[model samples]
Target: MSRFEKLSHVIWHCQYHIFWVPKYRYRILTGAVANEVYRCIQIYCGRLGCEIVELNVQPDHVHLLVKVPPKRSISEVLGAVKGRTAIRIFKQFSNLRKKPYWGNSFWAKGYCVDTVGMDAEMVRKYVKYQEQLEKQQEQLQF
Candidate 1:
């Protein structure tokens, strides 16, 4: 049997982080945008057969921690999330639909993803605390 054929019993948790285009910057990622992204993420995860443990939408990027079944690949899950969010964002924001919000691409090609083991508490905490950390960094800039 091939690896694809193997019936592995795995509960995989993954984190996906992706950024926006350069000129658009993080400014476009407001509370409204974040809420839309969050809603879209939930719907997309359901469609992809993944369980979203948590999600944090920052100014520059989005952090999603999801639990995927063994049959699913990490890349597949992230791609779904990114693709759906981008489409929804562009549709909702007419300005984004105009030239140059994404520069032909709604999201940067590269992303960061990490696999978590049984010890998922740390990862969960980090995801939950991401916004707080960003706020602290912003305060320090003053």
Candidate 2:
């Protein structure tokens, strides 16, 4: 009935717009490389229990809209995704190793992440309405 996901202990809805780039910003993510990247993302996210709301693999960058669990920090989620994907990608596409990815790292040093949710005005309105409902409930109980 609710959009919230039920875990063993927590019910939550946390989504993130995550973006990252390849090492040296190269446009090598074309053809087979792109396909492999997509597969790697799907496998890793599935294993981590993170759902992919949407995923776009670009030549030099990637855009992922993912629903992560409350128990996992953003850093932890991204780290697992990025780290394991890099390993899998390189192992599958060994030619990429000769291109620019030194130290066996495919992605760049860091990534960009933003939360996806309601705007401030909506949240403020909801909070105000919630308080009013509580007040009405107290009156009914008396």
The numbered model that scores best in TM-score is 2
Candidate 2 lDDT score relative to the true structure: 0.90
Candidate 1 — which residues are off by over 4 angstroms? 1-25, 99-101, 119-142
TM-score of every candidate: 0.64, 0.89
Model 2 poorest 10 in a row by lDDT = 95-104
Badly placed stretches (over 4 Å) of model 2 are: 135-142
Cα lDDT of model 1 by residue, 1-142, tens digit: 3212123565334443333332335456667877887798899988877777777777777777776666667777777777778888888876876774466567777576766554678878987799789999999999
Candidate 2 contains a number of clashing pairs equal to: 0
